[model samples]
Target: MTITATRSTELDQHRELNADETAVKSVRARIAEAGVEYVYYQIVTLTGRVVGKVVPARHLPRNIEHGIQAHPGVVADLQVDGSGAMLAGSPERGECVVLPDLDSFGVLPWDTRTGFFFCRMYEPDHAPGDDGGRPVPIDARGNLRRVHAGFTARTGLEMRSGIEPEVTWEVPGLSTEHVPGTPHTMYHLEHMERLRPVYQKVIEYGRALGLDMIEGNCEDPGQLELNWMFDHADRTADRLILHRQICRRVAREAGATVSFMPKPADDRFGNGCHHNISLWDGERNVFVDPDVPGLHLTQTGKDALGGILTHAAASTAVMGPTVNSYKRYLHTGQFAPLEINWGMDNKTCAVRMPANGRLEIKSPDSMVNPYLSHAVLLAAVEDGLTQGIDPGLPRTTGTGVPSPFGSLPLTLKDALDLFAVDQAVARGLGSELADLFLRLKTREWERFCASVTDWERRMYGAEGC
Candidate 1:
């Protein structure tokens, strides 16, 4: 008797793409047209960092077929645990293959000779058992793609989102200090003028790289929130990653440093990347209630909101991934959401209806990993939809009335504890990714707890003691 190996879902998808000779030819033609000499095969890490190899354009076809091999540890950013053991896997672990999504090919506007493609990782074909050519479980970007696809197939609803990326640029002459008699710089035209060159370069690169430049304004002395049009959740995540890359390049050119830190200082406004999301069923918006006047949500929308609120605390581990990220929540009156409630156009609520059909989640800070954030959100929303979770009444006032859904976690440690127990949120990231994310973040929290800050010295040193 003859036996054959079973094909994994990832291997099936990979095999299906192998037949797309037209797409391969089109990418090659575009590269030739642009006079591109080098191409980057980039993969997003667990922490949302982009890492990959650059190859000469001539090898594009060979690369597309064979793909690139990299250590699986790259997905974890190659981070180590408390004992200095690799958090992802051992050095002896077999390499994974990164295959490009040809549709994502784009040439760098700054460096016309070079182009790049966002890739998905899979276990190498030579891997043992059914794992061969399977999607790497820790591949956050790939996971989001599969998650969204599954959600849409099950519910016939697509999640569309736009991210308001607020970044602080440390320029030579810019100051965050408040002048005693002068008005605040929020939305001030003069402050924007000062950084015109920087924003202009950023917007230019963003548009060239496929972002539909919508609007932007100076939010604080050195903080700016530039926005682009909303799109499918997966595309929006990719755009957010590209936006960060663009800002980094523009900052280098302008001799300024860009900070995506949630809270750079106690007094300064926290840098937030608010996700404005809506659910769509074909051409119709499922979140909008056409029969009701003023601000109202459809049953589907409310259920989704309820699901998100229920899981918000647990999901915070991904939204606010660092120790400093929690500081944004502790700082009072900084526009960061403290409660799990949702209200009409309420900035103080974690989930708020910024528009008739959209909900803006403010808990996600600038440092969030979009892939992980969206995955958790999709899972939570699906739970709400399937279980018919009720969101209850919306809070009309900004007062600290306790939400039945509870408060957002005040620290990374607390958030991780919640994340560890919430199987629903963990399901969104899959078991493998959830475990790795928890390990990496837990290590981060431990490191922060062990280290003494300047505040500690000020409170306990000889001067105070």
Candidate 2:
């Protein structure tokens, strides 16, 4: 029941099986009622990719007790460099056990006969810990839980978040033509009608998978942003991953390719995964109504902002996560943050206080792994709280913001460099995870730097100048 910063083996499979007895009975009843034939035992990788195994529902009881086997590399995207060399570790290395989080079991609404459950991974035949079989260090889900537990233990507060995920959909060779006065548009009802079928399916499937689908709207030419009710940080992260899967499934049937790319096109607004966060103590919102001035956020909220802004530059490596991600930040007027300042109800800063109760981090793109994002923030906030970190005054005018402190790292490379050396971030993520993550991302940046791109060709292809 407890997750520590150093070890998570405190949760044993047998212990989970015992604690999940009620969940087992409930899932079994639902399985029989729904006639589910197969169940997928899945886990999210460091890059937020869903990977897992499929087993017949008849074997559910056995799987619940013993779990399934998966290669360790998959937890790190089974990454490869430009030369096809594995980045984190060899694919031929040993495997790990993937155990189901019983409460996460849900029937796939798209196909009622099949069910799914998100899993937490551990080393093969080993109990999770520093001495025992350690939880896979590169496993983002497990790491997030560890960080969340540490935060709760230190502060006795629960973090809650609601995520706004925006993505683009494109059907190959589709024409712009539509009925007169029904042109493609942003926030127009007619355009919503045009995309309704696709998103409707997404919403339906999302709700079935426990998304609590609240609403959605068209943002760009082919972009849509959907929202869901907020919950504990861990559950919200799981739902975000499931939301991506649901969107992809819905888009596939419509014969369209879906992209969570931060900047899918040069001329339009990029897709962003904005996180709205608040903290709770029992039933009360601790981030609100302390009668603080300016944004009216409590001292605790300000401390959290201080921690987030302090770690903003280093954290961008995960929040943005790719070369193209920085492109979205570089553009002006796209509502992307180019600086690390926090502001009152302003979308231009990296951390925005949109209301008195919570803070919205604007830097995370659609590609972010919610687990990592939340974990890093938890670490930063914990640091702020323990050290009594101050967030400084909110920037009322964009021009009045000071230089250097106000800016974030300009590129993935810069972000990685900062992440590698930051003691606070390293301690937050655990040295083992922080080192492996740096290796994975450094490999990505290296690959991008070595590749010759269309931009290079366009600028250099003219006859020798």
Candidate 3:
């Protein structure tokens, strides 16, 4: 069934269940064949964390017909403000329904008896007026799908992306200590070999769950980056979420702890989730300029880049959500982009054209919410295409050099301020999501401001004594 803005989600649910009997039967057959006993109906939250309910495989048909219900505040991670009030909504707001996407069904490789499905959220049927069973506006995953569909319908172009997620692992025999004169372990073969068992299991599970594992390596002392082939923006986002889950399971089995934190230490290199993006028109890459020389972009690519640069600051609040996320930007010579500019093969620029036909956005950290990030990017690109925005020449100077376009937002507060004013970003996230996101992040910023840190205590404790 086609989902449109005008169509009620209740009607869509009814049509999908009534017409997709064959698909349901197929899933049942697969479940029996795989001996699956339990199923997880997973939902992605506003912060990209996974939250949901699990049901027995025997209840698949019943659950699909009537989705599982949970408090809508899960979208905000059930967070509370300084006054101890629920951030998402009041308790009387009732629960939301989570319906699984049939196409996302897959058996867990770690436990063959268990399977999972990514779900879309909807308001409960007993809601006031016609709001019943309506799509949840604050649902990040659902919002991305809707936004992408609208973008494709309007522009006849598709955005494909691959994310390079860097994670730090705390494992046995892996030391963060660096000898004074010895070479560091970044990309070293010995370090990669030490983490072979960990990466091997991760890749195996990833492949079983439909990730086309391509390559991986050990960067820094305990950091690793394993990548898969890029696909449609929505699929990429789903895979990223799955990848994190797989990493967690692997870490549990290996007696290690994995961290997706952007900056784990003051002296260490920050973890970045750089997005390699391209615009496609059917089989052709619209960003490519085959007639031009090396590392050239088409006019379409330039405009898209302009939009990204134009909205880079506003998007950073989603890309780097945590308080520690801004710490990644404080260090120089760390590959993190400090300036809001594009460059050809320059790793220090916020947006870099590493090769033709794609741009790599360096602003996103390991903790980014891909759903929100991609949605904002789509809006920025759409505005660029519509307005014919032009990104100026690429930067060729060294790191710390200022660009004509100014620097990236240094703090979450700064980014939030920009996000508050940027209509394109607000429109991208939709009004409801934008408002919810702003509220959550603003509370986070305020909490951080109210707390005292070790640095502050160390400096101020002895001052004027």
Candidate 4:
């Protein structure tokens, strides 16, 4: 459906809101049945931040039929790419419509009167003569959908994945100072019990938000690792986004701050969102190759691992998207990987075959955008499978052996450089996305480099020669 912009002075006058009849009916039913008074129409920005406009539940009809209007360039608010410039030039562009995914309508467990819906951006005029009016090109979730479709079409297989999201939280009065949970004592039940009320609420809200909420353990001071049932790759990615939102909301209500920053502190253990993956064909677990000795992952598994390893450096730009993410990779013994290698039940390697059929990529951190990360890995795996690439030996030569695929990227800059030059990643993520991402990250790197930190000021202040 098309809606002419009421406020034309700000941007364009036309808007396109695309939704089908069935979706509209479903959304309407949910709003009434759930007694939801307000609905947040949300989208994920390039920085993985959730930003959007909220509409009254009374306007569910309008929003479902003709998506709510939002600033066209909001998704790229921080996306400074190619020309070493931010998206400021196109700031005044007209509003774009965000079509709500009816399937995503869920009542915020913490607040029953409010509901939330994830949306996809589309240009106003999808006319034949219109040049720029199309599906928002930078939509990571949309891009992942496209990539997943192509992979399924080509290989007749689907990927299943589970995410172990480790996040840290701090309470208002009790946990004033940021510190690791009792120094190096991992998974202590006492820590979990100490914060039982806070985490219990998290689990409660998580289930209400449609998450499976398998279990959670205290990883460090104020840090907890939560698990949910795994599902199809795309679905799992969606769940991760919801999972993060739930954690934050729950923490806020408890008068605490929750963070998914990969490395919130330099000395403590960084939060890692490790990806556990497997491939399937129909009802069969193709990844489980009983004929293969030892690890038992099939040839298909090897190829996928090979593709991932081949693009390990470039994928780091997505897996570990933030500047602080690099801090997690500082050492080998810290559970974060320093080298690009796959091993059997080895946490030190980039990819670890923790179970018989499931493989885990330890490179990604809590900072990753789940949609983009899953898309990148799927594309890399496809590249490997299609070309029949081998992932080399399983690094069975032991923990101290030299890295076969060399060292993983240590910083956002290094990852961006490798990502920019990698044709495979370019093809995987599409040139447009890869270029835009590089631009945004380059700007981040520039900002970081330009900033003078407290440590820098302290150390170099006295050395003014």
Candidate 5:
């Protein structure tokens, strides 16, 4: 399996290519067998994967370049963090393989111009391994399963989740963030007009990706949301990963860069990856008890909420994992809550009891690996349950914004450091996973840290000199 050129023919170079080709062929055959006509997939280094279905069209016939692409990395403005920082120097650009995920094949109920494979970025020669192989570290699906099984075993409760994404999309080069030529409110109609074809393409893409998605417009103009049907926590997280990719791709073909940047523009509002998660003790809601006086939430439910809040600061790394993530929590001296307080009907708190039974957190944004983020989040909830933590009556003594509850980290480095100190993170995620994450994130942070900022240079050139 070790196939360096310096190595033996036991590791044939041609064999790897053949193996990858076979894998691709096998998957393509599976899609055919499944009666699927379109397929799509995306590849990114870390993890979070889903495959989408697309309808093949005469015009968009299989792209001549049908693989994970690399063309000298010449797109000079490639921003790694999506935070507007640019990387310099041409990194070695090589072809990364993108094989379709046949397991994700499905026929589109709508338009059929494109099909998709939830693609995998694989080593060219890497064949599908033994029937079962160790998971890639970034695989949120695997990570969530590991944690989900652990939590259910201990509490006899499993979680189910659904999402309501609040997003705004426009044709490319129309960004208010980078270019501020027009009123933000007026851009939606134009966005919608251009988005029509993209919407049809999305329907085609969703089927290939195996997403049970339904799309709709939201209260905002270009504002749109896609509802991914409910699934167990582990699986739902995986779908979100794929969902993000699908939405972006369809948007791009229609000439838009789908952004999940927490706050793309300072003057405008940011988006929230609102999670509606509930625990089920074998299909029955655990938090559903209509009565008040110590009966509103089962002790188990309260424990989970308490664990999340008490450890809220520590969990900030996962919940609000990026610098931009904190931007949504504006501290403009208004009623908006940047702190960690929770209450029913209180959007003011980090954790809000939206209604009678459901608990919601607006802290997490789309940039997160939904599965990994969910796992860490669940771990926090699990910790509270185990410790029998009490959320203590939601500051219900009739309070004014429940006294600000500090805030999440302002930068990736800050979040990484906070995660390092969280004992619950270590306990829930396991040392190997936690340590590996720290090391990886630290490297990413250093990369950002060492880079020279255009802002710093422009602002300080003459003054500093």
Candidate 6:
């Protein structure tokens, strides 16, 4: 995905730290053991800076409920400035806050803090304009909330999601490319050995943290998938984010680097995070059609699929947000969709309905922000519904459309240029964030453009320098 050059900002790098002891006692127990001095969360703005920070601990003393209703200025602090630097504001730099998200608290395996709670930052009523407000625009979590609200408001249909993230293993001595396509290695054996223990731990952590969590090892070598037990949309996305960090931390301790990059290697398979989303109406599965032959998706499913396919090109900047992500699109006549079309059970189509209610978008890989990307997907779906687009004649195979989808930006330069004029996308992401996202991504593109790679140096020799 690309951004215009006008929007870069600085960011912080410090790792955020938050601890809670659900097993031993509560937030109180963790504090007694490790000193409940403060809780930390990673702050990313729709626009502006994205950083890691510790938030005000005033809520810690006030009680758990107050912690959930954190103030807006502090929530504004959640977003990093345009530079990607971490924030060290006075409220965030010092003091312990009692974080109480029963659904969010978990002891990350690698970090081993015993208790970590992903929180909702809030500002005091007297602190700013829009009393008791939060950085509403920056809240990716809020986007999910609205999505859930949209579903409920429309059809009493609620949605739950399970994110499938794949990875290629890499070590200090070996490149990630070497491991994924290694013909000599046992099938998916390496990732399994490392992930099983973490899976068990996630189960335990899920119980304590009130997370609906289930861990599964997929068929891909060195790749793993985590499924949160079905819940409301907000909880699903939250668990997915925090769970990913937990997986990364645990894997690091196992002497491996795990990345959600769209394509980690050219020789071997690439990694993509396929999200499994199901809608439930009360206790009934709204997506399932048992009697209607071959699990034919209902009309609603088709519309949702249409939303994804129609917006695939425009959504590429966010869905396939990273440069490495495009590599996954190079389909080798194998399983995996690179094109922006939809077919029934077609893995090659960007959007697929494995069944009538099972809506799957294959384009979202490991690189982009899950929360943000999912929001965009919902926005696309919203558009499809509002626009009454029909996903006619389901396809189950790649159509081999040689032409590029609306000329996808091949590099950072291309992305920024396209993003600058993507009015529909800009409206969905909102003005502030759209500007910030464009600016930051644009800056990164320039960083690449202004530099010389070894390939360029070798080809041009001394003249290039």
Q: Find the candidate with the highest TM-score and give its number.
A: 1
Q: Candidate 4: where is the Cα deviation over 4 Å? A: 1-24, 78-85, 126-133, 172-183, 290-294, 397-400, 463-465
Model 4, residue 28: what's the lDDT?
Answer: 75
Tens digits of lDDT, candidate 6, 1-465: 897663121100001122334432465555556544455544334321233455444445444444433333343344344465432233444322223344454454333443456544333334444423333444555455555566478656666666676655553443233343446333455645545665566456555555666556644545556555666556666665665566566556657677666665555566777776776778776667667877576666666666666676767777666656666665455455655566677676666667656777776676657666766666666666667677767653445544233334455456567667766566556665566566556655566667877768778898755
Q: If both were scored by lDDT, which would come out higher, candidate 2 or candidate 4?
A: 2
lDDT of 1 by residue, 99-162 (tens): 8888889999999899999889888888898778789889999999999999999999999999
What does each candidate score in C-alpha RMSD?
A: 1.6, 4.4, 3.2, 5.1, 9.0, 9.2
Among residues 3 or more apart in sequence or in different chains, the pairs in candidate 4 whose N, CA or C atoms overlap within 3 Å are 11-94, 12-94, 81-439, 180-221, 181-220, 181-221
Kindly report which residue pairs in candidate 2 clash with one another: 9-128
Q: Candidate 1 has what TM-score?
A: 0.97
Q: Scored by CA lDDT, what does every candidate get?
A: 0.90, 0.82, 0.89, 0.79, 0.58, 0.56
Clashes of each: 0, 1, 0, 6, 26, 41
Candidate 6 Cα RMSD after full superposition onto the native fold (Å): 9.2
Q: Which ranking of candidates, highest lDDT first? A: 1, 3, 2, 4, 5, 6
Error at 194, model 6, angstroms: 7.3
lDDT of 3 by residue, 1-465 (tens): 987776456536643763497888788888998999999999988888999988999998877777788887999999988798888877878888788888788999999899998888887777888888788899999899999999999999999999899999999877876675789888899888888889999999999999999998877888999999999999999999999999999999999999999999987889999999999999789999678888799999889888888888888898898889999988888899888998899887899989888999999999999999999999999998988888888888755556666787889999899899999999899999999999999998999999999988877888625
What clash pairs does model 3 have? Answer: none
By how many angstroms RMSD does model 5 differ from the true structure?
9.0
Flag the better candidate by TM-score, 1 or 2. Answer: 1
Q: For model 5, what is the alpha-carbon lDDT of residue 207?
A: 54
TM-score of 5: 0.68
Off by over 4 Å in 5: 1-30, 33-138, 172-223, 290-296, 331-337, 395-398, 401-405, 463-465
Candidate order by TM-score, decreasing, is 1, 3, 2, 4, 6, 5
Q: Name the lDDT value of residue 136 in candidate 2.
A: 74
Candidate 2 TM-score to native: 0.91
Query: What's the distance in Å from true for residue 245, model 3?
Result: 0.5
